[model samples]
Target chain A: MENGYKLSYLDNLESESIHVMREVFAEFEKPVLLYSIGKDSSVLLRLAQKAFYPGKIPFPLMHIDTSYKFVEMIDFRDKIPAKENVNLIVHKNDKYIKKRMHPSKFGMDKCCKFLKTKSLLDGLSSGGFDAALGGARREEERSRAKERIFSFRDQFGAWDPKNQRPELWSIYNARINPNESVRIFPLSNWTELDIWHYIKKENIEIVPLYFAKKRKIIRRDGLILLADQFNSPKEGEEVEEAMVRFRTLGCSPCSGAVESEADTLDKIIEEVMIAMNSERENRAIDYETDGSMEEKKKQGYF
Target chain B: MHKEKDLLRLVTAGSIDDGKSTLIGRLLYESKGIYKDQLTSIEDIAKKKGEKEIDLSLLVDGLKSEREQGITIDVAYRYFSTQKRKFIIADSPGHVQYTRNMVTAASTADLAVIIIDARKGVLEQTKRHSFIATLLDIPHILVLVNKMDLVGYSEDVYEKIKEDYLQFASRLPTHDIQIKPISALRGDMVVKKGNNMNWYDGRTFLHYLESVNIVSDRNLIDFRFPVQTVIRPNLDFRGYAGRIESGVIKVGDDIAVLPSGKKSRIKSIETYDRKLDKAFTPQSVVLTLENHIDISRGDMLIRQRNVPEIRDELEAEVCWMAEEPMEEGGEYLIKHTTNTVPVILKELRYKIDINTLHREEKKELGLNDIGRVIIKAQKPIFFDPYVRNHKTGSFIIIDELTNATVGAGIIWYPSATLPETENSQ
Candidate 1:
C-alpha cells in the first residue's frame, strides 16, 4: 500500500481526531479529557492513547460524577485510570449531593444544572484547564451540528453560538483569555455508526451496560429506564426484569434503555445499522424542549 | 459494513430558497441515512407549519433561529454513507455577507456543489460561491442547475445557464467542473434520476458524489511532516510525532529537519498498534531517527532535496473573518502548519470584489472582505505556494488582543522574489 495507498473513511476519521488531540497537547498549557464512561468516551480514550503512544498521555482525565450514574459505569471508571496509567479527577457537586438533588424532585433541568453542567464548569475552573476535550458529535443532535471543532467559551462558561469564531481548515485557533476556555471536540466528525465501527476495528473496551442483558427496568413516560438502587419504581410503577441495554450513558434517571439482545460488538453494530430513531432519542435531557440542547450548550453544558 | 470505503468532503453554499438544503436532504433521505425518528420529527414540524408536503429543507436547517428566519447562518455538517464511499457535507449559508462562512466550509472541501436556480440564471451569488470554490483550491466543482421543473425542463435554458457559468468560470482558475439540471424539490436527477429529464445523460448527483475521483487530489510528491510534539517515554526511547501532511516516508529514507536544516535517516516508523514500514499522507505516526536530533514541535520534516521556501516575508490572499477591520502594519499571531509566531500585516495590496472578480484599492479589509496582503513574520516559516500544496501553504492570523482567529490566508509568493512596488515601505 505504498504508491496506491488509500485511507478508508475510518482511517481518515481516526487520523483527523489524533491530529486534533496532538494539537491540543501542543497548544494548551493545561488540557483535560472529559470522560463520561460511555461508548463515545471509551472510543475517545482509545484515540487519546493512540495519539500519545510511546509516551503516557500528556493530560489527566476528568469525570463529573452525577452520583446517579449506573453502577457498572462507576465500576468501570474505578479501574480504567490506574490500568491506563493516567491521572483521574472525579468531581461532584458535594453541596447539591448532600441536599439530595434528584431529577424527579427538582425537575430534569435543575438537576442537570447542579449535577452535570455546574459540576463540569467547576471542574474546569478548579483545574485551571485551558482546553477541555469532549466526545460530542455533530450528528448526535440538531444544535450540535453547528458547533466548531474547537468551541470557545466565555469567562462565565457560557457559549455564544451566534458569535463563534470561524474555524478554517484544520488550523484550530486555541487562544483564549486567562479565565476563558475552549471545548475541543476531536470526535466532532464521527457519526454514531462510525464510533461503533471504530470500536469494532480497534477492539476497544466499553462499559458492559451497552450490551443487552437481563436487568431490572421500569417504564416511565414512554421511556424504558434502568431500575437500579439510585432509581426505583414509584408507588404505581412496576419494576420487572427484561433484556434491555442503554443507548447513551448519563445520570441513571435521565439515561433511557432499549430492549435488545445484542450482547457482542458485531451484534451491536448490526442493531445500530437497522435501528430507527437516533442514539440521542433515549437521552431525556434533550427532549425538555425544542431547542433544549442549544440552550443547555449556551449555559456551558457538555 | 466491513468494506473499506474512502471519505469524501463536499460543501454546498446556498440559502433555503436556492434548494441547497433540499438537495442535501434528498441525498440523505434516499440513501437511507435519515433515521425514522429524524424523519418523523421533521414531518411533525412541517405539519405544524400547515404545509401540504413535507419540507425537506427543515431536515438540514438545524438551528431554531435558522428555522424561524428561513436562512442558514452558520455551517452545519451532515454525514451519509453509500456502498462506495462515506460523505461529509459542509452546508453553509449563501448570502453575500456570509462569504467568510463559505470560505470556512470550502477550506477543507474536496468538491463544491454550486446550486443555481435555473430560472434565475447565474446570479452574482452563484459566481461568488464558485469563485471561492476555486480560490480555496477545491479540486472538483459540480454545478447543479436546480429548479428545472420551474423552468419547464427546457434544454435551451439549461444550456444558456451552463454557458454563462462556464464563461464566468473561464476567467478564474481551471477546475474539473460538471453541469447537470435537476429540480431538488421534485427530486429530478438528484438520487433516483426521475423521469422528468430523459434527455440528460449525466450521472445523478448522488452517483457523481460517490464516484468522484478524490484519491489523486492529495499531493503525494512532496514529503512534508510538521512535527507536532516529541515523544520520550524513557531514557531508552525518543520519537518525533506528527501526521504526514503529504507524500510518504519509509524507514531508512533520508529526511531533513526544517528551520534548523539538520539531516537524519528514518530509523523506525512506530504506531500504537505495531511498527510500520512506511506511512503516507494524513496518517498520524511516530518516527524515530537513526541519529539523535534536536527537533521539537513546529519543526517540519521533508525530503532533503525537495525543500520548501524558508522566508520571513510573504504575500498572501487573505479572507478577513472578524468583525473588526484588519489594520495595516498591525502585529498579530500567524499559525502555519505546527508553527505559531508573531506577524505584522506589512501592506494591504488590494481587496477583490467578490461579485466581479476585480481588484480594488483598499486601505484595510473589513469583515467578510477578501484581500491580498504582505506579511512579515518574526521568524522564517517553511512554506509552499497554495496552488501546489494546501497543507504547507495556508496560515491563519490571530488577533493579539482578543486572541480570535481574524483572518485565513493562502500564500502566493515569497516577498524576496516579488518585484518591488513603489508603495512598498
Candidate 2:
C-alpha cells in the first residue's frame, strides 16, 4: 500500500480508535486506562500516545495486579509508564491477599472477581473515575462480542446485556450516574492480524513469554501448563521440558502455554495464521468451566 | 494520488457455520496479513478439533461460546489494505438473534459483502442482510455465492442464484449492486480471479473493492465541521478542535461558527507538531481562528455559503437496536456530533419492511426494526442530509435511565410545524 495516500488497514483502524479515545477524554469527567501488560493493552497504550501527540496522554494508567503475574511483565509495566511520563497507579488485591485467599477455594472465576474486579472497583471508587478505558476486544470471547464500545455499567457495577446502550456512528454518550462507570474499548474493532500488523509496524515491545522458549511444563487438564513455583504440581503430575509460549497473559494458575517452536515474531504470526482453534483453547481454567468469562465480566473484570 | 483520498468501509454478514469466518481468514491469509505463530496456533487447533484441512474459521471465530458451539455471535472486525485503497471490514454474525450487531456494522459501511450458501440460494437471512444494507443507504453491495465447488463449479447454479438475488433486490434502495460466484473455501473469486468463471468478465472480489470509484460519494461542497473542543496552549494562540465533517477549509479562508453565527478566518491548522496549510473532510486538527470567538465544544464551524439546517424538530430514519421499542412521547438523550440534548419521540411515522421495501404504518417498532420517527428536541441541532454529510446527519438515542444506546437515527427533515423562513435570502 502507498503509505501516504492509501492507509493500511491498521492505519485506518488506528485513526478511528484514536478519534474515539479523544472523545473519551473530551466527554468524561475523569477517565483512566486499565493497562494490563499484554498485546492488546500495549496497542491501546500506543494508540493513546498517538491520540494526544505533543501532549501526554490526558488520563492516568491503572493496573489491577493479582500479584501472580510474570515478574517481567510488571517490570516492563513500571518502566514504560516512566518512559512515557504517563500517570501510573499500581493497584493490588491487598486485603484479599492479606487474608491468604487461594484460587482453589473459590475457583478461578471467583478468584478473578475478588482479586481483579474488586481491586479495580476500589481504585475507581477512590479516584472518583466515572469512566475507564479498557483494551478488551470482541474477538476475545462470546460475551465480549456483545460488548459496546462505550458499555454502560449500573450503580452496582453489573452489565445487563439485554439493557446495553445502542452505540451508533461515532457519537458516544459518556454519561453515568453516581457509583456507575463506563468501560470504553478503543480497540473493539481491531483483529488479531491488525494487532500483529500494528506490532510489526510500530515495533511495540511485548513480554518475552509470547515468543517460544524452552520452559518447564506440566500436563494438567489435557493441556501443557507452564510450571510456576507458586502453583506446585499435585502428586503424580509429571513435569517435563517443552517449548511453549503464551497467547494471553494473566494469573499463573489459570493461563496455560502451548508447546511451539515458533520463537520469532514472523514464526509466531505464521503459527497464528494457520491455527484453527480459539486462542483460549489451551487455557486450563477455561476447559474446566463454562461461562467463566461471563461471570467474571459481570463482576467487573476489565 | 487523486484516488487515494477516497476509501471504502465494508462489512461481511454470515455465521461460523456458513464459512464466513473462513472467508475472512482466507482473505487476510492470501493478502499476506497473517503472522507465522498465529498460523501455527491455527494449525494446532485444526489438529485438536480433528479437522481434515486447517479450519480457517477458527482464526476469526474468537468468541468462547461461538467456538464451543461452532457459531459466530457478534460483529468481529478484520482489517486489510491493498495498494489502491484501505479497508475496515466488519464481519458480522448471520443469526437472526444478533441482528443488532449487524445493524451496528452496517451503519457506517460504504459497501456490504452479503455471503450466501450456494446450496441455499437467497435464504431468509439473505433477504434480512440485504434489507439492512439498503436501509443504511450503503452505496454499493456485492453478493458472494460461496461454496460453489460443492456444486461442481456449475455455471448454471451460479446464474440461477444471481438471477434470484437480482429479482429480489429490485426493490432495495441500494444504488450499485454486483454479484460474484465465489467459493471462499476454494479461493475462487476472492483474492485471485477464478479461472472457472470465464463467462464472468467482472473483476475478482479484491480487485473490484480496490478499484471502485468512491471519490464522488462524499458531498464536498457542503462545509460542516462540528467543533469537538477548544485548544488553547499559549497566551497568543487560540484554536478550535474538530475533524472536518464535509468540504474543506484552508488557511486565511473565512468561516462561520454555527448557532452563534460568529464569523472568523482560519489562521492555521495544527495537527500535533505540523502546521497544515489546508485541511479537508475527516482530518482532525486544531484550527487557529483569526480572532478569539465564543466557540466551545459542540459548536460547529461551517462555510457561510453552505449553511446546514438548524431546527428543534427532526424527522429521521432510525434503526431500533434495543429490545425495548421506542415509545411515542418517550424522552431520551441524543448525542449528535459533539452535542448532547434531550429528545422526545413525537410520532412513529412508519416501520420499514426490510425484505420487501414496504412501509408498515405501526405505532410501535421492536428490536432490530427500522422505522421513521418525528422527534422534538429540547434544543435545536444543526445539520445536513445524511447524503450530504454522514457525520453531521447521524446520531444515537441514549436511554436517560440506563445510558444505553437504544436507537441509531439519521435525520430526514426538521419538522412540518416549524415555519420555513427563507434564510438563504
Candidate 3:
C-alpha cells in the first residue's frame, strides 16, 4: 500500500481509458461520444475532457432521447454541452413520438427499438461518424464479458460475436470499411465499484435521481416503477410514495427503482458494497430471456 | 479514503474438461465476487438442466452458443479484487482452433495460469498452452493440477504431473513456474485450504495469485513514448500527448523525437489533475518541450542517448488468426504503437509444430498456426525486441481487404544483417 511511485488500480484504469480516448480521436476521421447522461456517461465525459485537456473535446456528444426519460435526466442532459464547452446532438425519433409510441401501448421491445436503437443508427449514419465512443463496461453483464474493447460492427450496425478481431496488448486495430464502424469502449475494464470510487474521488456531478428521494412509485411484477407523468397507476394498482433510487437510468418506464436511503455518495457506495443484487437486476430489458442483452447488442443496441 | 490497490492481469488456458471454468468460478464465488442475482440465475439454469448441484461453469460461459456447446468460444474477461490487488482474468478457450483467442489473452497478461487434469498428466494441449505462455513472454506461470479429488488427492500423482510438466517446460524461456494440486468441484485449495491435501503443503491458488511479485515485470529502465496526437489548444500551447510505454520521464530531461532525430529538453508534464514533476510507464500525459520540434502522431520520443533500433525490415514470430491462409508476398497494413504502414510478407521461414516444438518448412500459415516470417515495411519503425519490451515490440497485422486483425506478431529484432534480396520460395 505504500507504493506511492506506482499507480493505483483506479489510476491505471483511468490511464488506459484516456489512452483509448486519444486513440479514437487520432484514428477515426469522424468520431462521436454516445452520451447516455447516466453515471457511466458522466465518467466517460470526464475522461474525454481529461484526455484532451486545455482544449475542447475533439468530438460531439450524441444522446438518443427516447422521450420517456425522467424529467430530471433531460434537464441535466440539456445543461452538459454548455458547461463542458462541447457540442451536443440530441437525436429524438420525432416520427415515433408523433405516432405516440409507448412501452405501455407498444411493447418495451418495439418502443426501445424505434426510439433508442433506430434513432441511434439514424443519427450516426447522418452524421457520418466512423467510430462511436461509449461507456460500456464488460463487468456489467454476462455477454459483455466477451466483447472486445474495439468492437467491430457491420455496415448495418450488426455485431458478429463469432468473428471478433484479436485485440493484443495495448495495440488496437481500428481499421474498418467505409460504411462499417467500431464501438470504442474505454471503460471496458472498470467495475461498478471502481466507477463509484472514481466519481467520489473526482467529485464528478451526476443525475440527482441516483440519490434517494421521496417519489411516487408503483410495484409491478416485482419491479418498482416511478409513477410519473409518463407512467401512472393502472387499474387496481396502488400508487405509493417511498424513498427509492434508481441503480441505472434508462427510459423511466423500463428502468426500475430500488428502495434505499443512501442519499449521499458515501452512503451510496456503502450500500453498493453490501447490496445483494447486481446493478443490472433492476433493468427490465434484460429480463426477457437468458441472452436478451446479446440479442440486443447483435442488433446494434448499446 | 482508502489506499489504492495495484492491478494484475492473468490469463487461464487449458484444454476442454480441465476444470478451467470451474476453477475461475470457484475463485469468484469464494472471494464474494459473485453477486446474489448471478448465483440465482446459475442455480435456475442448473435446475433446468436437472443437476443436483449448481454448475459453476455456467457463470463464465456467458454466450448462448457456449452454453449449448459446453465450451468457451472466445476470450471472456472477468474482474475481481481482494484487499491487496485487483485482478483481470482473461478466460480463453483451449480448443486447437481457438489458439488465436489464447494469444489475444496472453498479449497483456503478466501471468498465465495453465490448468492440467491430474488424471491426464501433461497432455499435448498442456504443452501447447505452455509453449504459448512462454512464447508470449508471460512473466509467471502457475500450473494447477486440478481434479485432485477424482485422483484421490494422491501425492504421487500430483508429483508425477508436476515433474512431467517441468520436463516439458525446461526448454521454454519462462523461468517462474509454480505447480499445485486442487479440486475445482470440491473447492479444495482454490480460495480456502481444504483438509484433503495434507501432504501437499504450499500456498493455495488464490494466495499465490494475491502474493505473487509482479512489480519488476515492467521495463522501467528504458523510456519510450509514441505520440498519439498533438494537443494544440491555442497558438501558445503545443504539447505531445501519449502514454509512456516504458521507463520514466521528468522535467528538463533531454529527449529525442524518433525518425526525425530532433532533440529537445522537457519543459513540463501536464495532466488533467495537475502538473507533474515526473511520470512513469503507462501514464497518459501531455508533455511540452523547451524547444519547438516538429512531432506529430506516429512519432516516438525517447532519451537522446538511448534509442531503439530503426529499421524497415523485421524478423518476427506471427500467429495467424484469420480463417484464410496467409498469401505469400501479400501486402497488408502493419499497426505498431501509433504508426500504421504498408507491409509485405517477405518470407515464411518456418512453422512450429505445437505438439513437438519442431520447426517445419511451410509455405503458408493457416488459422491458429504459429510461424516465423520476414516482413518489409514501407517506412522505418522504431522498436525494441519483444523480449526486451512488450509494449514497443508488438504489432498487429490488418487484412487490407477485410480490415480484420489477421495476425499477431512479436518482433525478434530488426533484420538488417539478413540479405535483402534473398527471396526463398
Candidate 4:
C-alpha cells in the first residue's frame, strides 16, 4: 500500500521487526535467533525469512529445551527443520536434565534458571554468539516496559536495569564488548492483540494446541495443566477432559491453559479483544513472587 | 482519508509532577488495554500502603530501580490501540539529567506529546524537551497543558501558557504545533472531552491520535534503499534486501548503486513472499537486478537521477551520552545506514547552550552534551540531510575501545560554507 493507501498496523510492525533482524544480519556476526517455537517466535522466524527472503537465514536458530514443554511444541519444532533450510540447533542442559530437574522438585524460578537461563547461556557461549534475537514484547509485562530495542548485557549476561544505552530511531547501536551479548527484541513494540491479528493475516502456522481441544486436564493452583506423560494428577487430585486452549506456551509444569472455545483464528482474535486479563497472567513463573520477571531478567533470563 | 491507520509512535516528555505517567495510564485504562488482575493488584498494593491515589505512575515506571528511585531512568514503552490505529508510547524520564533519554525517545516518534503542568507554565524543562523534540525533527507536537484542575480549569491559564509556548517554539524548527489544555488525572480532554471544559473546543487526545494525518508524513520521494544483506538462499535466486527509506520503485525500473556507481535495472521487487507491481517507502523488500552487479550490505540502490548526497566528511549536531568527554581527535565508528566506517572528531565547531539556545564555543562535549562537530569518515557514505529524511541522515558513534554507543549525530550540511569534502583545510 502506498500513496493515499494506508499501511495496516500489522504491516508497520512487520516492517519494523524485519528492519531489526536486518540490522543484526548487517551489523554483527555470530548472531543467533532464540527460537521458542511459540506464536511470537514463529512470527519472528517468518520475519527472519522475510528479512533474508529467497535466502536461508544466515545464522542458526537455537532452542534451549527444558524438556517440560508440551509435546506438540516439540513436534512442531522437529517438523520445522526438515521442511525449512534454516540451521536449527536444539540444546538442553544435559547435566541438569539427567538430575530429573522439575518445578516440583526445585521451585519454578530455580528450574527456569537452570533449564532456560543457564542452558541458554551455555548454548550461546558455546556457539560463540555475540547477539541473540528474541521474541519478547513490551506489552507483556510492566518490568518489560524499560527494555530497549537492543538491550545490552554485561559480561555475565545480566541486564543492568539502570544503565541502558539510548536507542535512537532505526540507527541501533549494535556495538558491544566481546564478553557482552546484546539481547535484541524484534517484537518489543507489538502487543498481544497485534500478534494475534498478524497471525491471522499471515496465516502463520502455530501449534494446534493453541486452538480449543478436548484433552485430559488437572486443575491445581488455579491452573489447568495437561495430564500427560510429563504432567499427571496427584493423589486425590481429579483429572478430567476439558475444553481449553493455551494463552501462552511454556514448560507444561508451569504453563496454564485458559477456558475457551476459540478454535479458529477469528475466534481467537475475538476472544483476545474481549479478554480482561493479561496473557502473562496464565504464566505461573511470573506469579512466583513480586518482580519475578525483572529479577529473572537481571539474572539473564530471557 | 486512508482506509486504514498505521502505527503511531509517540513520546510523552514532561517535568516531574506533570502527570505524564497518569496520562498514559489513563489512556491505557480507557482503551481497555490494562488487564483486570493488573489493576486489582495495583489497587490492592495502593490500599495496603495506605495511599490515597492509585499512583498510576507505578504502571509506567516498571524497572526495579525506577520504582525504588521514584523516577524513570530510561525510556519506558507502552502499547495501546483503538480500532483505528495502534500506538506505542515512549514514556521518557522527566528529570533534566535524562535529556539523552528524551532525545532517544523522540528520534523515531511521528508525534510528541509535550506535557506541561498548567500551574507551572513554560518552565526550563518544557523548553528543553520542546527544543529536543524539534531538533530531532519530530513532525507533530501536541502540547498538553496538563493538570488544568489544579488551576481551576481556567481558559485564561490555558491561553496564557499556549501563547508563551508558541512564542518559545517559534525560535525552533517545528513542522506542526498544536496546544490544548488537559487534566490527565481527572480524565478531562484526554480520551473524551471533559464536562468542565465547556468553553474550550478541540479534538480529544485519543481522537486526534486516531485520526491524525500520518500517511502524508512519510517521505515518498528520493528513493534511498540501503542494501542490508545479499539474499542468496540458494543457487537459483540472488536478491538484494533492505527496507525502502523513501520513494517508490517498480519492476523494470532503472537504478544506480551508490559508492560503486554501478547501474542496473530492477527485474523484480520481491517482498520476501511474492513479487509486487511496485513497492513504496518503508516496505522491506528484496530486488533482483537485470545484471549481476557488485552490491554489498553498505551499498544503496537509488533512482539514477534522484539520489542522496555522497560525502566523505560532514558537519553534525551530536548528543554525547558517554560518561567521558568527547575528544577532539577521537576515532570512533560512525554507523550510517548499513555502513559502519571509522570517523574522527576533526573539529568541535560549537556547542549549543540549551539554556540560551545559542551556539557557544566548547572544546569537548561530556554526557548529555549537544554540540556541533566536524566528522571525517574513512570513506564516502551515501546520506541525506537530517532535515530532508531522518531515516537516511542520522547515525550513531561507537567508541572503538569500549564498543559503547558514545553519541548520536545528525548529518548536517552547513549553510555558510561549501561541502566539507571540497574544502582544502
Candidate 5:
C-alpha cells in the first residue's frame, strides 16, 4: 500500500499505528495486544507484525474470553496463531463458568462484570502486564471519542477519565507504577470504515461471519441476538431467519447483526457509506443506560 | 477509492464562556458526523436535564464532573469529517491550571482556531492562546471572532477585533493567520455564509479548514529518517524500519547512518504489502542497504551530505509538565524520535510570559511553566531546530523516579556545528 512518491490514506494510518506500537514496545515491559479475533483485532495483529518487521511481536496477545464468542471466531483464533507465528494466550473466568452464572440470571450488567471485565482484570493481574493495547477506535462510541492514544489507568486498573494525563503530540506518558496498567489504543484514530478499507486492501483474512449469511436470530430486550447456547428462544418466542452481518463483534449474546446483504468488502463499504447508524449502535451493552459506555470505562471495561 | 490526503489536525483554544463547545457541536452537526441515533440520544439527555435547547456541553465533556460543573477539565479528542477532509480536534480546556493540556493538544496540530468574543474583543486568554499556538509552530491560525449576533453583525466590530488580534499577534512569531466572523449560537458563517454577515465575503470557518494548504510547510529537501526498529523478518532481508521525518529517500541512492556516519547504498525500499520505489516525509518504511552495516533503533538515516546537528548538550524551550518544579541539576530521561537518553537540566535561563512576552528570570519552573533550559544528554542525540522541523527537533523529559513525563522540550538552538547543507529553508 505504500507509495514512495505519495502516501496513500491507508499507508498514513498504518504508519501512525506502527509508530504507536513501537512506542509501547519501547516504554512498557509487559504489554499484550488484546485479541478479540474480530476485524479490528486482525488489523492490530498484522500491524504488530509489520511494526516489529523481522522481530516477532515482543509481547504475547491475550484474549479474556467470556466463552460465549461465535464458533467461527474461536476456530479462527485457535488456528491463526501458528500461521502468523505470534504468541497467543486465552483466559476465561472458569469460576464464573463453573458456577453457571448467566446474564439472564444475574442481570446483564453484573454478568459482564464477572464474565468479561473481571476475567480481564484477573488475566492482567496474573500475567503482570503493565500495558495492554486495545482494539477500540474513537469512532465507535461516544466515550471512546474522548480517549487518548495511550490511556492511563490507576493502580486498581480503574480509568479516571477526569484525571487522565495530557498526551501532547506523539509524546505519550507511559510513566506508571508496576501495579498500574496502561491501556493503549494504537487504533484510536481509525474509524470503522478505515478498518474495512485496510482489511480489503491488505487482503487480511477475517472470520467469514462478518459477511452476510442466514442465521437464526431472535428479538430479545430490543436486540437481535443469535440463537446460541447463551441465547435460546424463550417460551412463546419465535426464531427468525435473515441474511445478516455483524458491524461490530463481541460475545454472541450481546452482539447484534444488522440485516445486510453485504457479502463482500466492496458491498460492505458501499452499505456503510450510506448508513446513518454508527457501529456502536449495534452493541447491546452501550444501550443499557445513558452514558453506559462511560460508566463501563470508569470501571476498567474495554 | 479516492486517495485523498486531506486529513487536517486542528485545535480549538478559548475560554470556557466563549462557546468553544458550541462551535465544535456546530461543526459536527454541519458535517453530518452526528448520526441520527446519536442526535436522538443527545435530545433524550437534554430532555432529562430539562434543557429547552440542545445542550452540546454534554457532547464534548464526557466526564461527570465536567458536565456538572459545565467546564472542560482535560483534553478530549473529537473526530469529524467533511466530504473534502477529515478533522481531528484536540479540544483542550481553557483553564489557567490546564495550560499544560493546551500545549499538549496544540503540539501536533497543523492549524489552530483561537476563538475570541466579538463583543469583548481580544482578551488576555486570547493573547495567551495565540502565543502558545505560535510557540508550538502551528502552521495555520484562524482568529475566530465568534458571537457576531451580539455585535449586531456590524462590520466595524469584526474589523476592530481583527486589527486588535493582529496587533497582539505581531509580537508573537505566528504567520499565515486567517480571521472569520461567526455566531455559534445562531449559526452564522460557520458552515455557510449567513445572511447576517453580508460584509464578510470571506469563506466560512469550515470551508477555510477544508482548504488550508499545509503542503509547503514541511521540509522536503533535506531527507531525515530516524530508525525506530530493524525489520529482519528472515535472513533473506535486513530492512531499516523507521518513519521518514523529513525529505525523500530513493533506491540505489547513497545514505549515511547518523552518529556512526557509516555510508551505504539503498538496496530496496520495503513497505508493508510491497516494495516502494521512493518514500517521502512522514511515511514509515523498511529500507534495505547494500552493505548491511550495524543499524538499529536510535540511529538515523539521511542523505549522504545533509545531516542534522549531533550534540550531547542543547538549549531548548521546555514547557514544564509535572507538579514538581524543574531542578537545575536533576537527571531525567530525554526521548527524541526513536532514541532515549539520560540527560541533566544544567541551568534554567529564564521563563517567558505569554501575556507580556517578557523574559523574566526564574529560579524553577512548575506545572505549565514555559522556560528556556540547558540540558546535557548522556550521549550525542541528533536533532534539528524547532523552527525548521518538529519531529526531529522536539523531545520530552521524563522524571527518572516517577517515570512521569515532566517536561516537553523543543530545541531552540543546536551546539556549534558545521552547517553542511546549503539547502536550508
Candidate 6:
C-alpha cells in the first residue's frame, strides 16, 4: 500500500464514491447528504468536499436527530458547520415527542419510522430535496449486500430490494419524479475494513463512544447493551458494570456495545479488522423481526 | 516494490446449485480475504446445520434466509487481492429467473468466468450465460468445468464440454474463451494446479485470473470527459470537476466543451491537493481551464477533433429490465455519463433473441429482453457508439412514474456522428 500512483482498495473506493457524488450533483435538481454524526458519514463528507474541491458542497447536510445521541456527537456536529462552512439542516422528530412518542409504546420499528425515517422525510418534503446521499454499505446486512450505487425510491421513499434499477459502468440513473427522492449510497461498495483503513489513512475525526470506556451496562440477548437514557433495562433485565465500546452508533436504545478493551481508533480498527460478526449484529432493531430492516427500508428508513 | 497490482473486475455465472457461491467462497478464503472471526462464525453456522464438513458456502451466503434455503438468491460481491491483481468478483445467482442479476453484474465486468458442471455437459443455462457474456462484450471468458471428480477426471469429458462451448461461442462475438477442468468441491485446478487433471495443459483458475489481459479492454482512443459539476471557490480558485470517461488528458491540451460549443486549453488538472501532469480514464480530477466559460453539469470536454456527437434523436439497443413492457408514449429518464435527460420511446425497432441470436419484430419488450429502439430526448446529448466507447455510449432509462431504472441502453448511432445533419433537422 504505497501512497503513490496505485489505486489501493481504499483509493478506488474513494474515487468511485466521489464519482457518484458528482453524478448526484449533475443529475439531480436538488440533493442533500444524510449525515449521522458517525465516522462513515464523516468520511462521506470529506469525500464530498474532495469531490467539489475549490467550491463548497452544492447540497446541504441533513441529520435526522433521534434526540438521544451522545453529547460528544452533538458537540462535534455543532462545530462542523463552522469548520467546513457548509449548510447543515437538523431534522428532529419534535412532533413525535410532542405526541409522547416512545419506543416501548409502539415497538422498535415504529419508533425508527417516526424518529428517523419520518423526520428525514419531513425535512425533505419541506426543503424540496430530490436526492439524499447516504453512507450505507452492503456489507452491513444480507438484503443490503445486493445494493447498487444508485438506489431508486418511490414517491413515498420505499425501497423494493427485489426490483432495483440496473446500474452499468459509469452511467448512474439519478432521476426522480416530484415527491420522489432517491437515496444515493456513495459507500455501497465499501466494506467496514475499507472504511477503517480510510479513516486511519486520512486521520478522520469520530465520536468518542467508538473507543474503549468503562460504563454501567447490561448483558442480554447475547449482547453487552450500553446503558443509555432509552435503554435502562426492563423490570426483568439486569444491569451490570462492563468495559464496553460501540462498534456502531445509533439511538442509544437500539445501539449496543461489545465488551472490549480497545480504546484507541487503532486498537478499535484492529478489533473490527478481525471481528467475524457483521457490524449490524449489535443493532437490536434488525433482529426484532425476520426482515425488519428490509421492511423499514420499504417504508423509507435510511 | 513490484509494480502495484492492477484491478481485475470479473463476474461469475453458472446454473443454480452448480457451486458458484462455493467456488467464490473458496477463492476468497484461500486468498486470505475472509477475516478470522468471519471464518469462525461460518464454521459455527455450518456445524449448526449438521454438515459433515464445514460448508464453504457459509462464507458468502450472507442472508440468513438464503442460508436456511440452501441457495444463493441474489448477486453478492466479494473482493480479494493477491500479489498480482486485485479481484472484484460479482457472485450472481444462477437460476433462470435471476438472469437479470447476471446481466447487471456482467455489464461492467471486464471478464466473465462461466462455471459448468462436468457431469452436465453444455446445458441450456450455460449457453444463456455464455451468450450474455458475449452480448455484454466482456473481453475475456474463462469456462470452468467443475465436478470433475464425479466424471472420474476424464480428459475426454473435459474436451467434450470445451468443444461444445467453443462451438456455441463461435457464433457469438467473443474473444479469448479458455477452458479449464476443475472440481469446486474438491478444490482441484482452482486456486492451484492439481494432479487429478494430469493431461490438462491450461493454467489454473487463479493463475489465469491473475494473468488475463484486461488493459486492452479499455477504450483509449477518444478523449471523453463529462463535466460532473463546476467548482468555483469563494476562496479565489477556479476548477471544473469531472471523471475522465476515456483516453488521457494533460496540461496545456486544447479542449472543447460540449452543448455550448466552447473551446479552451487545460491549465491544470488537480485532485485533492496537488496538480496532475496527466490523467486518464476513471480518475476523478478537477480541471482549471485557461478561459472561464459558462460551463455547468451535463457538459462534456474532449479534444476538438475527436469530439462526441451532440444529437437529439438516438437509435439504441436496449435491455428492458422492468416487468411492464416498454411503450412508445412513455417517458424515461435517460442517463449517459453524468448527464440525465428525459427521453421518450420514438419507435420500436426489433428485439434480439439471446438463444438463437435472431431479431424478432416486436412493438414492446418484456423483462430481460434486448431490443433496438429509436428514442427522442428533450435535449440534445453528446455520446458515442456502444462499440466504440462504453463510457460515453451507455445510458440507463428510468421510468418516470415508478422512478425505477427500467432499461439499459447502448447507442447504435450517435448524434455526434451526424452533427451537420442533426443541426439542419
Candidate 5, CAPRI quality class derived from DockQ: medium
Report the error of model 6 at residue B150, Å: 1.5
lDDT of 6 by residue, B1-425 (tens): 11245778899998867777778878877876665555666667667769767777666665656667877666777777777877788877787445577778887788899989888888888888887777677788899999898999999999888898888887876477888898887889988777898898788899998888777667666899888777877646678888887888889999998888899999999887577898877788999889888887778889989978778998988888888889876788887777778898888788888777788988888888888889999999888876668788788888777667788887886534544432111
lDDT of each model, Cα atoms only? 0.89, 0.76, 0.90, 0.86, 0.83, 0.79
Question: TM-score for all predictions?
Answer: 0.97, 0.82, 0.97, 0.96, 0.94, 0.88
Model 1 chain A poorest ten-residue lDDT run: A1-10
Taking all chains together, the TM-score of candidate 5 against the true structure is 0.94
* Cα misplacement distance, residue B186 of candidate 5 (Å): 3.1
Any residue pairs clashing in model 1, and if so which?
Answer: none
Please give the DockQ score of every candidate, comma-separated: 0.74, 0.22, 0.74, 0.71, 0.51, 0.35
lDDT of 3 by residue, A1-302 (tens): 22545888899999999999999999999999999999999999999999999777999999999888999999999999888898999999899999999988898788888998888988999999999999999989889999989999998888888888889998899988889999999999998888999999999999999999998999998899999987788888999999999989998889999999999999999998777788988998886788888888888988
True contacts kept of each: 0.75, 0.24, 0.78, 0.81, 0.46, 0.50
**In model 5, which regions exceed 4 Å deviation?**
A1-5, A54-58, B414-425
For candidate 5, lDDT tens digit of each residue in A152-270?
Answer: 88776788776666666676667787698899999998877778878888889999888998998998766788887778898988899989888888888888888989999999988
Pick out the ten consecutive residues of candidate 3 chain B with the lowest summed lDDT. B416-425
Q: Which candidate has the top score in lDDT?
A: 3
Worst 10 residues of 6 chain B by lDDT: B416-425
Clashing pairs in 6: A212-A263, A276-B37, A276-B38, B309-B416
Looking at model 1, residue B236 earns an lDDT score of 82
* Model 1 interface CAPRI class: medium
Interface RMSD of each: 1.2, 4.9, 1.4, 1.8, 2.6, 3.5
Model 6 agreement with the true structure over A1-302: per-residue lDDT tens digits: 12233354566677789999988887788899999988889899999988988677889998888887766678889888998878999988898967867777888788888988888888888889888899998767656766677777888888876566777776776656677778889998776766776787778888878888888887766777677656678788888887888888887766778888998777977786567566767888877765567777888887
